[model samples]
Target: LGITFDNKLHLSGHINNITYKAFRTLNAIKRKFRHQDNDTFLTLYKAKIRPTLQCASPVWTPHLKNQ
Candidate 1:
């Protein structure tokens, strides 16, 4: 699993890691598909960026309000 934990066993590190990866993928898609139409961009986003953000979600998902 790609999930990570801190000394306190918090999922913050895993969340941050996935967030960074997702944003980076989004930026890349924006740059590479600048001329693409809305439908095409949506497709790309769903196929690429969404997966990065959603991967291992059940394992790292926050249950506490402060998390």
Candidate 2:
């Protein structure tokens, strides 16, 4: 999935309740995306993933203690 606003693009990987690894990867803090890539925002946040007409909700990524 993807979200766009004011010419900004936010990319979301595959989302499935049974398989959260894909989406989880996006939620990872250390998981940096390639803004230069043609994909999307460079979404570095969790909730950024938008729901599709099909069926899929976003989940929060567990954060570590340290920054």
Candidate 3:
């Protein structure tokens, strides 16, 4: 669950399995890393595929704010 920023039209995808196991894992991570920094991800599914489908991000990003 990191950050992402992209704008294009190519292929498409789907999240066919939004199961409780996923939620439990995410919740566990959130709790475990509660005392850490604000912008952190305990586990990322894909290090390269995540950043290809996002728009408004941290809002504090300098370049994104300019747009």
Give the number of the best model, judged by lDDT: 1
Residue pairs whose backbone atoms clash in candidate 3: none
TM-scores of all candidate predictions against the true structure: 0.87, 0.21, 0.31
Residue 26: error of model 3 in Å? Answer: 0.3
The C-alpha local distance difference test score for the whole of candidate 1 amounts to: 0.86
Root-mean-square deviation of candidate 3? 10.6
Superposed on all Cα atoms, model 1 deviates from the true structure by an RMSD in Å of 1.6
Model 2: runs farther than 4 Å from truth?
A: 1-18, 29-31, 39-67
Task: Evaluate residue 20 in candidate 1 and report its C-alpha lDDT on the 0 to 100 scale.
Answer: 88
Q: Summing lDDT over every window of 10 consecutive residues in candidate 1, give the lowest-scoring window.
A: 58-67
lDDT, candidate 3, 1-67, per-residue tens: 4332345521111121223335555666667667765445623423222332222224323343323
Sorted on TM-score, best first, the list reads 1, 3, 2
Question: Residue-wise lDDT of candidate 2 within 1-67, one digit each (tens)?
Answer: 3322233322222223423643665555345654434334444332343322223333323233421
Highest TM-score among the candidates is held by which one? 1
Superposed Cα deviation of residue 14, candidate 1 (Å): 0.9
Model 2: what TM-score? 0.21
Cα deviation in Å at residue 64, candidate 2? 35
Clash totals for all candidate models? 0, 2, 0
